[model samples]
Target: MNKGQISNTLRQYRLLYPLDKLRYLVERNKNKKLNEKFKKDNPEISLPPDYLMYESFQIDYSKYYFGGKTTAEWIFKLLGKHINLSGGKILDWGCGPGRLIRHMPDISNDQSSFYGTDYNKESIQWCKNNIQKVTFNHNNLEAILPYEDNTFDAIYGISIFTHLSKEMHFNWFNELKRVLKTGGVILITTQGENFRPKLTGEERKKFDQGELIVKGNVKEGHRTYSAFHPDPFLKLVFEDVDILDKIVISPKNKGYLPQDRWILKKKALV
Candidate 1:
C-alpha cells in the first residue's frame, strides 16, 4: 500500500475495530435472517451482506430503487441542457450496490452505456448479479482506476469525494480527467458551507481559510471520514475545467440536508 492508503487503513482500523464487532452482532444477523426469508420467495435474487451496505444502511428494495431513479432524473434534468444524458457513455464513480447505476437503463437510450465502479468488492459483486444493462467494476481506494484515457463522456460521483482526505482530491480529479473524453462533464457534490456547523473549532478555522478539513478518525473512504470544501477551494482545485454551474441548495428548498453541487466540463485538448 502507498503512504496514503497506509494512513487510511490505520485510521479505519482504529475506528472500526471494536464497534464493528458490536455492529455485526446486532445488525448482521438481522440482515441474514431477512435475506433467508427473502430468498425463499425470490430464489434468483441476491442481497448484499450487511457490511456491503453503505453506512450500514438498509431499506426496502423498491424504495431504494425509486430513490436511485429519482436521483438519476434530477441529474438528467440538470445536465440535459448542455449534454445528452441519453446517448453517451456515463459512469457512476462510487456507485454502491448499484444505487444510481441501476436506474441508468431507464433514463438513457439503448446505445448509451452505463458503468459503475466502487472500492467495495461485495457491492460490485452484488450489482453484477442483480442489475441489468450496466457494467460494474471494483476499484482501489487510491487514485488509479482501470480505464483507458478519453473513455467516458460523463462521470459523476455521489457523496464519494466527501469522505476523501484533502490530499487525495487533486490526484483523484486528475485521474477522472485522464479517463474522460475532452469536453466531457464531471458532476460532483461536496460538503461545502452546508456542513460548516458540524465542524470542530479548528476545522472551522481551516475551512474559513479555504483549506479542506477532514475528519479522519473514522474509515478512510467511507462516510466515517468527511471532508468539507469551500467554494474557492473547489475553483482552485479544478482550474483546468470549465465551471458550468455550482448550485448550493438550501435545506428548506430540498427538505433534506443541503450539499453544494458542481458541474465541471473538461477542456478540449489542444
Candidate 2:
C-alpha cells in the first residue's frame, strides 16, 4: 500500500473501533428515532418496503462516519470524461437522493440527458422535488426498468455494487448493459485491496473486538458489502466490453475504505 492507502487503512481502523460500539447499539435499537423522523417529515409518504427500511436504518448511523461528496465528485469526473455526454442519455443507476447527480457538473453544455432511480420512495420523491432537470423513478430491481434497450449512452453505479450480492450484481450488470448503447461507457466503484479483509487469528480477534470490519460476503439483510478482486470480477461481468481504465483513489478525508473505479465501454461491432 502507498502512503495514502496506509493512512486511510489506519484511519479506518480508528474510526471503526468507536463505530463498532455505536453500530451495535444502532443495530440493537435499529434507529427507531430516525425512522420516526422519516415518517414525521414525509407524512404523505408510505413507509419504505421492509427490507429497504432495514437497510436505510442501518445506513443512517453509518453515514455519520463515512458520508460526503468526495465519492460523488470522483464518480462525476470519471463519467464526464469517458461518457460521450454530447447528445447522449445517462442513467444514474441506484441513485440515492440524487446526491451524485446533484453534485455532478452541469454538463448541459454537453447536451447530455440525466435520469435517476432508486428503491426508496422517500429518496425518489426528494430527488423529484429537488432536481427538476433529472427524471427520477421509484423502482425496485426485480421490476422492469422504464428505459428501452440501447437507450442510454452511458450508465453508472457508484458504490452500488459494493452493497449487493453476487446475484444482484449480475442482474444489474446485465440490465445496465441491455440499456446501454454500443460504445457506451459505465463506471462503478467498490472496496479494493487497500481495504483488506481480516484473515489471521489476530485480525479475527480484532474484528471481534471491533477494531476491524471485514467486507466480503453478506448473508442477510436487503444489502451487504460484497468485496471482489477487481480484475476477475469486472472481466467476468464485462466480458463483451472493454475495460478502459481501473484507477484507485485514496480516501480524501478519512473513515472510509479506499475505492477502485472501473471504466468500461460496450464493444462496438466491427
Candidate 3:
C-alpha cells in the first residue's frame, strides 16, 4: 500500500487505537522542548494539557494559542461583516478544548454571548475549568444538541464537518438549522476540492461528480475519520439555506493545507 493507504488502514482499525495514542505520545514528547519554550514565553495564558489540545487541534502550545487566536479574529471578522456581532448569541459548535471559542470575548466587541460544544468529555471539562467568559458543554455523536430553538444568532464549526459519516451530515445540519434564529448565519469549514490531490482514483471520480468522500472505520468525531465535500454535494446539502459566501482557502505556504469556508444564512420559515 501507498503511504496514504497505510495511514488509512492504521486509523480505520479500532485495534490500532492504542498504537495511535502511542504515536501521538511520542510525537508530543519529541516536541516538548519547543512547547516548553512556548510556556516560558507566555506565562499568563492558561493552556490545556497537550493531549487535550491534540484531541482538538495541535499540540504545539504556541500554535494552539496564536493560531487559534488568529483564526478566531478572522472568523469573527468574516461573520461580523454579514451580521451584527455586538450582543449576538454566537456558538462554536464543535469547539475543541476552547481554542477559538476562548477568544470570543476579546475578539467580538460589546456583549456577545459565546458558547462552545463538543462531544469530547475531557475537552469540555478542561474548558469548563480553564476557559473563562464562555460556557462549554459536552455533546453526543448523534445530531442532537442541548439548546432551545432559535437560540443562536450565529454559529461556526471549524473542521467539524470533515470528521463525520455521511448520515451525520444531514442529521447535524438539520439540528444546527433548528437552533439557528431566522436570518442567522452558520460559518463552517470543510475539506473540499483542494484536497483532491490526496484522494485515490475512485475517491477522485466520486468527488469530481460532486459527492462527499468519507474515510471511516475509525471512531466518528476522531481526527482520523475524514470526510471530503465537493461543491455540488454541499450545494445539495445546504439547499435550504441561503449561501452568503463560499471561499476556498488555498495553501499559500507549507504546513497549511486548503479547505473550503462556507457562510450560510438560515432562511425564514414559510
Candidate 4:
C-alpha cells in the first residue's frame, strides 16, 4: 500500500497515534541548531518553549516568531477595509502561542481589542506571561468560546479549521457565528483545491466529488489530524454566513500547497 493508504488504514484501526508520536520524535530535533541561532538573533521578543512552539505552530522558531508579524500584516491586508476604524474587537480563534496575536497591536491602525483563545493551556499560559496588550483564554475542544453572543467585531483562525474533524467544521462554525456581531467578518484558512496534490488517491477522488476529506485517528485538534475542504463542501459548511470573498493563498516557501482564505460576514437581523 502507498503511504496514504497505510496512514488511512492505521487510522481506521486506531493505530495512527503512535505513528504521529514517532513523527514528532523524528522532527523534534530537526531544527535544534536553528532554534538556538534564532534565540540569539532576536532577544527582544519572548518565545514559547520549543515543544510549545512546535505544538502550536511548527518546529521552526523563525517562522513562529517573524512569520507571525508577516501573517498579521497579510491578515490586515486581506481584511483592512473591514477593520473597525473606531477600535473594534478582534479575536484569533485557535490562536497558537500568540504567534499572530502578538503583532496585531502595533500593526493595525485602529485601537481594536485583540483576544486569543486556544485549547492548549500551555500555549495560553505562555501568551499570558509573555505577550502583552492582548487577552488570552483557554478553551476546551468542545465547540464553545468564552465570550458572549455577538461579542466580536472580527475573528480569524489560521489553519485552525484545516486540523478539525468534519463535525467540528459545522459545530465550531456555529459557535463562531454566534459570537460574531452582525456585519462583522471572520477569516479562516482551509486546505482547498490547491492542496489536492497532497491527497491520496481515495481522498482525491472523494474531495473531487465535493466531500470533506478527513484524516483522523490522531487527536482531533492536533496538527497531525487533517481535513481538506472542497469549495462546494466549504460553501455548505458556512452557508449560514455570507461569503464576502475567497482568496487562495500560495505557500510562502513552496514546500506546502496553497490554502484557501475565506472572508465571511454575519448578516443583519431579519
Candidate 5:
C-alpha cells in the first residue's frame, strides 16, 4: 500500500480502537483509593471543586504507576548536588495532599521547613489530617502567597503548571518569584516533546488560528489534558528564573514518552 493509504488505514484503526479506554483503565485504578479517602474525609465534597478532580486522579495514578523513593527524595538529591540544604525553607506550590512532604527523608526534615498549599480545600484538609511537621493552606494562584517575600529557599511543583492556563501560569510565576529567596531553586515537571497529539486538519487549523488545541489521553473527571511543550513555555513564564536543567524521566525500553522534569534556580542579585 502507498504511504497515504497506510496512514489513512492506521488513522481508521486508531479511531476504531481509541486509546482513551486504556487511559480510563489506568485512571480507574489510580484514583480509586484517593477518591475513597477524599470522600471519607469530606463526605460533602463534590466533583469539580474549583481545582480539577483529575489533578488528584493524576497524582494517584502516578503513585500506582511510578513507584519510587519519593518525589522529595529525588528533588533533594537533585538540589543537594548543587545547593546546600542546611537551614533552608521549602514551599511546595500545588502540593496536593502533601505527598512530597510525607516522603522527605528524616534527616532532611530537620534541615528544612516545609510548607504546602493548594487551591483545593479538601486536599489541604487531607494534608493536615495525614501529615505532620508541615504547614498546609488552601490558597488560589491568583492571591499572594501567605509568606513574606524571599521567605523560601526552594519551591517546587510536580505536574502543576501543565494543567494551568497561560494567564494563570504568568500570575503564579510572579508569585513564586516573589516568595522565593535570592539564589533559591524551583523545580517543576510538565509534558514536553514526548507528548503526542493526533490532531485532525481542522484541529491543526484551529491551532494555527491561535487556538490552544491540546489532544491527548483522556483523564477521568477532568476537562482534558492541556499540556504544553516545556522549552517555549518555560522560556516565556520563567524568563526571570534561571533554568538549571531539564531532565527526562523514563525507563529504558519502555518506549513511552518521558515527562520533563525542570530544575530552575532563582538567580542571586549581585
Candidate 6:
C-alpha cells in the first residue's frame, strides 16, 4: 500500500476500534469541558464536542468558534442566490454534529424546516440531543435513505462527495434527486482540479483524463477514503440535473486545497 493508504488505514482503524473508542470518549469529555469554559467566558459562542468540531470544521481549536458559522454562511449564500429558502424543507446531507445546521436558525427564515443526517450514529445523536429546531437522523452507507421521496426543496452536502467512492457518488446523486422535489436545488462540493498537486502520479494522470480518482480502500462509508472529481466527470455523472453554478472555493485561502462547489437543480417533470 502507498503511504497515503497506510495513513488512512491507521486512521480508520483508530476511529473504528473499541480501545480507540474509549480513548476518544475520554478526550471528548475533556474537550467538552474546555469548550464549555470558553463558551461561558465568551457568553455568545456555541460549542460542541471538540472531536466532532474538528471533524466538521478544522483541527485548530480557536477556529472552531467561527468555522461553523463561516461554512454555514457560504451554504446560505449559495442557496439564497438560487432559490427562496424561506418556507422550504431543506436537508443538510452528511451534516456532521450540526456544524452547519446549528447556524441555520440564525440565517434562515423561521418558516423553513431544517433537517440533517449523517452516517455516523454518534454525530447524529449528539446533534439530536444538542441542536434545537432541527431534525437529525442517522443514515446507512447505502444509496437508500429513510426519508420519503420528494421530501426536500433543497439539499446541501459540504465536502461530502469528496469522500465517496465512484459507485457511491452516483448512488448518492440518484438518492439526492429522489428525495428532492422537482426543480429543487442541490449543492455539493468536491476536490476539484486544484487538488491535483496533492495527488499521486497515477491519480494525477487519471484526474487529467477527466476521470474520478478514488484514493485508498473504501469500507463502511467512512471519511478516510478520499475522491477527486474532475469537472467534466461531474458533469457527465450528474447529467440528469441542471448545473447552475460551478466554482473553486479555495483560492481565497492560500494554504487549503481548492474545493469545487456545484449548485444544481433537479429537472422538472417531463
Best by TM-score: 3
Tens-digit per-residue lDDT, 1-270, candidate 6: 754455455656664344445655665665666665666678755556666765555534445656777878888878989988889999999998777888887788566899999998888998888788999889988877789999999999988888788888989999999999998999998888777766666777888899998764445355556788898889887998899999875575647766888999999878
User: What TM-score should be assigned to candidate 5?
Assistant: 0.69
Q: What are the TM-scores, per candidate, against the unseen true structure?
A: 0.82, 0.65, 0.95, 0.92, 0.69, 0.84
Give per-model CA RMSD: 5.6, 8.9, 1.6, 2.0, 7.7, 3.9
Model 1 whole-model lDDT (C-alpha atoms):
0.77
TM-score for predicted model 6 compared with the true structure: 0.84
A best-first ranking of the candidates according to their TM-score comes to 3, 4, 6, 1, 5, 2
Comparing 2 and 3 by lDDT, which wins?
3
| Stretches of candidate 6 exceeding 4 Å from the true structure | 1-37, 43-46, 218-220, 250-254
Please give the CA lDDT of all the candidate structures: 0.77, 0.62, 0.88, 0.86, 0.64, 0.79
Please give the range of 10 consecutive residues that has the lowest summed lDDT in model 6.
12-21
What lDDT tens digits, residue by residue, belong to model 4 across residues 196-251? 76679978999999999988878889877989899999999888788989987667
Stretches of candidate 1 above 4 Å error? Answer: 1-47, 56-62, 253-255
Residue ranges of candidate 3 with Cα displaced over 4 Å: 1-3, 11-19
TM-score, cand. 4: 0.92
CA lDDT, candidate 5, residue 183 = 88
lDDT of 1 by residue, 158-223 (tens): 888898977788889999999998989999989998777766666678889998877688657865
Write model 3 residue lDDT over 1-270, tens digit each, in one string: 554466566655664567768878987998899999988988999998878888777788888999899999999999988899788899999998888998889887547999999999988998999888898888899999999999999999999999988889989999999999999999989998778766777778999998898877778989877898998988887999999999987788766786899999999989
Worst 10 residues of 2 by lDDT: 212-221
Q: Who wins the lDDT comparison?
A: 3
Overall local distance difference test of candidate 5: 0.64
User: Residue 178: error of model 1 in Å?
Assistant: 0.7
Q: Give the Å error, residue 4, model 3.
A: 3.8
